[model samples]
Target: MNGPTRRGDLFDDVDGARRFTGPTTGDERRMLIDVLRAQRSTLRLKCSGLGPELSLRSAEPSALSLLGLVRHLADVERRWFRQVLAGQDAPPLFSSTTDPDGDFDGATDDPQVVAAAWEAWRTEVAFAEQFVTGAPGLDIEGEDSWRGTVSLRWVLIHMIEEYARHNGHADLLRERIDGAIGL
Candidate 1:
């Protein structure tokens, strides 16, 4: 991987943190999915080009750094998609039944931790995307036990919203780490 940038200059490389500039077709569902994927890519970009120490650094007492956000999102995908969407009773990806924040807590500078996080998140994403593709259609009126009878459309919208919210958190955390912004 590329070496990290200097302090207060984390986003020095424009080519590295490029946002989603792909063509637009004006479909709401597709657009929303694309936006979420772009945000996901942006999160990855923020972590990239950084040294392990800097990537794992915790500027505040709370574990709300970019690394933590990555881990959290990975777990969220597994929980919402693999468990909820697929109607599986399995436990969360990283979080235990008793410890809800296990994913964030387990985040570390260890390569194994990072690799596992990526794999879990990517796999969940793939599963979620596949589910979306195979979906007969969005039924915003449908409800479920977990989501309180939400429609498929609602779930997709909620996922996008969740990602956007976390991406905002990621933006701040990334900025704090190296002063990169508005990628």
Candidate 2:
């Protein structure tokens, strides 16, 4: 397949990292989904090159790693989309009541672990997408014990915020792992 093009300082479509050219005319749902997809793509780009070993390497003294972030995002996706939104009985993919931080703490330099994280993340994302696609509208409500009734719009916004925040951490982690940095 053809590779990415470098135009000036920007690398167009490099490593599957699509630039986020905000939607100007779409409806609210479309715009929100587009923005969320862009953020997800940014995270993928940030974690692209490093293998499992490097993926598990903490940028600082803490247990924050690229693989851990992937796993954590997967859990977040499942919680909000499948559990909270769709009302599915989805349990945590990596974390649990006994080991709540397992997603991050269990991250390791194993290829299997890295692969599983990606798999889980992709699976949850697909489920989320399907849930959103089938929803009647953004106003549809979901039950959450902690937050009580929540609209799909609220969930989408929260997810976007969540991804944006973690993507910032991914940027720092990627920079520390290597000198690579970009949009």
Candidate lDDT values, in order:
0.69, 0.84
RMSD of each: 5.3, 4.9
| TM-score attained by model 2 | 0.88
- How many angstroms is residue 90 displaced in model 1 relative to the true structure, after the best TM-score fit? 3.3
Enumerate clash totals for all models, in the order shown: 3, 0
Q: What tens-digit string does per-residue lDDT give for candidate 1 at 7-85?
A: 5554555654445765488766777667767777776776776645434545556766666677777777766666666
Best-fitting candidate, scored by lDDT:
2
Off by over 4 Å in 2: 1-17, 59-61
lDDT computed for candidate 2: 0.84
